[model samples]
Target chain A: MAPQDDNVDAVEEAMVAEVEKKPIATIVIIIAMQTEALPLVNKFQLIEDHDSVFPKGVPWVRYHGTYKDLFINIIWPGKDAVLGVDSVGTVSASLVTYASIQALQPDLIINAGTAGGFKAKGANIGDVVMVSDVAFHDRRIPIPVFDQYGIGARRTFSTPKLVKELDLKVGKLSTGDSLDMSPQDEAAINANDATVKDMEGAAVAYVADLLSVPAIFIKAVTDIVDGDKPTAEEFLQNLVAVTAALDQAVTKAVDFISGKCLSEL
Target chain B: MAPQDDNVDAVEEAMVAEVEKKPIATIVIIIAMQTEALPLVNKFQLIEDHDSVFPKGVPWVRYHGTYKDLFINIIWPGKDAVLGVDSVGTVSASLVTYASIQALQPDLIINAGTAGGFKAKGANIGDVVMVSDVAFHDRRIPIPVFDQYGIGARRTFSTPKLVKELDLKVGKLSTGDSLDMSPQDEAAINANDATVKDMEGAAVAYVADLLSVPAIFIKAVTDIVDGDKPTAEEFLQNLVAVTAALDQAVTKAVDFISGKCLSEL
Candidate 1:
């Protein structure tokens, strides 16, 4: 009986090791702004895809390289070549995410960017949050059942192991096209129970869900939504600081996922 | 030389007849709500794709059939199954349009829906206007060069021949997630020179352009943005009437396009 028990233990340990070694090989990180993408791209030493991996005339930029045992690509919807604005809304986010998935065929997606946080939700200037859920705050379809549809609530890929391992803050994220929130948006955000809000997370989540791809949102708080200062002023002032914070958090997350399967994360 | 010239003319006439008979084949009409989709679906006698031509578990609906010489499909973002709310915004519009293009490989796309028209732009309720250009009104990123990017302006397919033949009013269409306009939205809409505004038009245009599919927008005016009544009230009151108008206009457009090439349109 003692010998049999020892043999069983050894077999179980071997199976666990085999599962741990099955890595999430390919990962696509979707960032809406060049400023936000630059740090992660540099940190990963990803080279720009100069041959125009995306559609030829569109401004979508892709940077890719192998980091550790993982094949990583960071995609920026890219500045509108003519307008020079970082394409920073759900429309651009969904398009780029869909394009990246179709081209790269990644096993996992990471939507990393800057977002405004709510102080009432215990957020600070430079905190990185692992978004647990995402919803829309500005799509106010007022019809009977459409009120909920307008919210477009979606659960992000579950990453309890990563959250716990990284000691990251977790919160619900709300998305909208506007930087400033209206009264209606505020009500919707409250309904969503969102602690953080951004221009692109939920849209990315929606695309990922549609494709049946696993996605995680890692957002750094750049401004306080409930704070007294104007949103634009606070957002600009804190963006640089939060980008650094975001970079560090995402780097940790990637490292943690290096040799692990999505189930382990 | 005269006999040879007559032979060349005969060959040319045969070529012309062959080209005219080639047919546009598959066309996709993207509508945001079931209310907008029902009339077109019924008019065309399109059969609902209950087996899910779209991805399983998504709320997107597809109805397809042949009309005259054209194979037509009508797609609605569909109500959230659980919430029972119509998915009526840019995010849903983009997703469904992208999915439809991937699945159907449409030769041309028609975005037919109802919109809020402006008295300032000489819009009358029930008037169906062919959108010449489409832009976003609510993506107000006020950065130096990003201002133009935020507007996300795109030209609809060139349909000067169709417009002249059909005697339809042509105007620019603006889009936003919200049914109600913000002051900022007003400024952007003015900048766009938009006569009509809706939740889904530009998003559909964006996806269509990305895929190199020619798309036409035929929006029926449902509410006057500058009118005395509130937007929601006016929208609800006029939705049924405008749906009929939208159906009639779309039917005419479809009939006109039955045996024409995209270039001919």
Candidate 2:
């Protein structure tokens, strides 16, 4: 065989060896709202994972499918975090995340959703962000003790090579319960130097950390929090566009993981 | 009749009129842990509110009873905000609080539970606190928009007279999703000037605010977040004592509200 053909055969052999040695298994994609989850679900053609039972009666649904030879489970915890009808915030997000972790035993977790970006940080609406670290911007434990508690900053694992390939913005993401913000909150966020804000990232990340499960957060910005338009309006108006971006990001993330596994061979 | 006797009769007549006019109807008490809630439930001899149903299968239970002529509902959402347990963080707390509001139609919501206090704020273990304002020390939304969102600082309705009567420490209570804290968290808490920290207060207060229902948070200090003892150890060691303090505070709060009804009359 020619030299180039021999190299190609060797690469193929290595790929098969890597798959046999360490194949990527289950991955759980946790999204707080159905709208935030739909794009990825449709892109992957995932079906509801009815066999994966949660502790019966928890208000959540899980979908699953094989993507790039890896099992992906998509979990929608509840409705939007917005006030009024069907609002699910941190509590539901955490519980559902914990439940999904237990039920699926995923090798990795990707919390894919939409967030409000900080324009000051060069993040614009529709920009996709990969959370490097998550902190509770709203969690105010008293000073001194807060540091001692060791929960001030929760960092997430990143596939550096994969991140480079995907060219995703890697930054801090802040999580809180409210969609509405105040000047004081803005100051806090700025102080933290977070690029994005969402309701469920911290909670979801916290659970994943506790379980020692590798997790990554991929968020598409639907609003510039400081933009002239109201946040609610911006969120609604850009939901479609942002979610589509999120869908693409999630796809890239899955491919990144799959490629990483093969490249390791 | 003598003048003294006539005055006494008039006073009695006014009391009767007050009862007829502004009777204490519904009071909801939202507690995080079952252990924290049991004291109040036992103290008041509360029975399960069979009529108050949540979305069938949500892991929560509500109890009700007539306390000092006011119908009281006690809701136990879940345990700590940690992983690998029956935990309900902000989401469950808010949802349960909202459900309780809808089902019980409470005129007042008292989020009664245990919290870690700031000793620098002169808070001692077993000291009962009445929340004047609730904010998310963990919820850091970025500036300009944060101010517009109106979620940075959520104030609770404080009846000065009632507070004075109950002799409770009225201060800011911070809410977050984690039980752990770190030095950095301490700085944030100090920045917010919060004296107490818990997982559920802000969520409950937020829902109550949205519904225009007056709410108060009554918390007993279980641990000084900065104390020498670990928070979990302190919490477990002081559980009974702190819960008792919470029980007493709740009773006083009930009496305070009931008295205000009578006083207005």
What are the per-model DockQ values?
0.29, 0.07
Tens digit of lDDT per residue, candidate 2, span A1-265? Answer: 1124888779977865654456568888888777778778888899976664764324467888888878988888643224212334565677677667766877778888899898888899999998998876655433344332323457887567767878888889987666756554576677678999888887788667655667888888999887787787788789987888888878877876773452331
Instruction: Please give the CA lDDT of all the candidate structures.
Output: 0.86, 0.72
Q: Name model 1 segments beyond 4 Å from true.
A: A1-23, A49-57, A103-105, A228-230, B1-23, B49-54
> What TM-scores do the predictions have?
0.84, 0.55
Please provide TM-scores computed only on chain A for all of the candidate models, following their numbering: 0.91, 0.84
Task: State which candidate has the highest DockQ.
Answer: 1
How well is each residue in B65-149 modelled by candidate 1, as lDDT tens digits? 9889999999988775556667788988997888788788888899999999999989999989999999998876655556566
Clash totals, every prediction: 1, 35
Q: What local lDDT does model 1 show for residue B222?
A: 94
